[model samples]
Target: MKTDSQLQQDVMAELKWEPSVHAAQIGVEVKDGVVTLAGEVSSYTEKLNAERAAQRVQGVKALAVDMTIKLSQLGKRTDADIAGSARNILSWTSSLPTDAVKVLVEGGWLTLSGDVEWQFQRQDAADSVRYLLGVIGVSNQIAIKPSLSATVVKSDIEAALKRRAMADAKTIAVEVKGADVTLTGTVHSWAERDLATRSAWGSAGVRNVVDKMNLV
Candidate 1:
């Protein structure tokens, strides 16, 4: 285990190392095992990248982000322009269905709403729009269509977790009610906990995942 100070150093180093993030503008602080990031960022992509970089540090138990987006003069885009760009990009994405996702932008904040068959498509829709030039924030409200029963969904998630090389699949419990999943158990680290949750979301009809998992 790493001390809070060591964890803070590693997270700062990771922020500096990630090419997409502007580490100088961000501040990192750790208390116990939780890491909090605060400051300003250039774009929504930078914000997401910063969060991911912090999570990559070995001893980060949890992350609390308070960064705000402050677009430079050259980076500004009208909400209409952002909406149009988001629509165009979603339309071009091969993985997403034709016109399945809808876009709305307000004050540089973008929101996606609609339905998709799989979680990856829903995720891809958000990913495509998140990197747009003027996007400050993204809300992925796209829902997954329910296509599997509780039993099948549970089994599928369990199987996926077992297949992951580093995950102790037996330590996690998967509870499904229709398309909703609740994960409850203990994992070795934050990475393992994330892997378990991702495995849960990978199932066909998981519309919502409630993570009640605790780190060891």
Candidate 2:
């Protein structure tokens, strides 16, 4: 395991390497295994990319994002324009249902809320708007309304995991309480952990997914 200082340095280096991020404007701090990002960026997309870059570094257990977006005069867009663009882009996305996601923009921040049947659709709604001009931030409040029963949800998620051939599929325990699913187990890497979590969220009728998975 890397020390806190070493992890901080690696995160900073990673941020600098990512072309989308203005790393010089961002500050990195690490303690224990948590990374806290501070300072400012040119846009919301850059901030998201910086956070993703930090997560790609090894030994990042958690993240605290304190960075803010400071859009240039030319980059600024009115809330109405941002909302209109978000709506137009969302309508263009095939994966998302027509008007299934509602958009709210305030202070250049976009918030999406609605119900979708699967996690991918909800994710698509957010992805469609993140790159829009003048989007300072995004809040995806889209909820999942699974079409399947509780029993079916468990079986379906397990089957999905097996189909993906996750090495720890057997060790990963799946629990469904009402529309909520909880995953508990150990995986070898963040990739596997994310895969397992996605499997749970992919199931029909999974309103919420609780990840109790730990990296081994």
Candidate 3:
């Protein structure tokens, strides 16, 4: 096995090779298989990319990202320019509501806050912000409001959970009511428990998942 220091070196090399980032401005440190990334980037995408580069390395047991984003470059742009850029981004993606979402830029940092009917739309908003030049970081505080009725949401969650349980063929029981999914019963291992939780997340209209499943 490669030592922690050697893994760190490899991660650094990987970051340096990525075309999207300026590797010199990023710092890498590893201890006991955990990799720590520090420094600053000009955009949110670069910061995300830097962390992803570290995660992809073969020997990384975990990642700790502490990178800062510089928004100063965005300060020079006019409001019209910023709004135009945001509009262009919205036009390129059909998943998000172009008008419902609001963008606020301060010292280059962009904060997006709004309510979207789907989690994918929330993701789309964040993605749009990251693509803009001079954006330091994006705070995605978008709420997920269901386009479907409460009854539909509950039905969807129940159906999804049932399908997942059947597919896994485990002893995990799932109970869904409205936006809440409760997992009960027992599984052979902790991995099964985690799998159940993830399966719940994949279900649409699920506001919150309560895992009550016990590991045997």
Candidate with maximal lDDT: 1
Cα lDDT tens digits, model 2, 1-216, are 899999999999998899998888999998988899999899888988998899898788888999988999989999999999899999999998888999999999899999998888988999889999899988999998757788998999999999999999999999999999999988876788889999998887788899898876
How displaced is residue 18 in candidate 2, in Å? 0.6
What is the TM-score of each predicted model, taking all chains together? Answer: 0.95, 0.94, 0.66
- Cα-based RMSD of candidate 3: 5.6
Question: 119 in model 3: Cα distance from truth in Å?
Answer: 1.2
Best by TM-score: 1
lDDT per residue for candidate 3 within 1-216, as digits (tens), equals 779889988999999989998999999999987889999887778888898788667777667988887656444566456657876786678887667687777765677777776666777788876767666567777776644455665555456657766544346666766666687876554445556676665566665668776544
Between which residue pairs do clashes occur in model 1?
A: none
Worst 10 residues of 3 by lDDT: 71-80
- The alpha-carbon lDDT assigned to residue 177 of candidate 3 equals 67
Task: Arrange candidates by lDDT, descending.
Answer: 1, 2, 3
lDDT of 1: 0.92
- Number of backbone collisions per candidate: 0, 2, 1
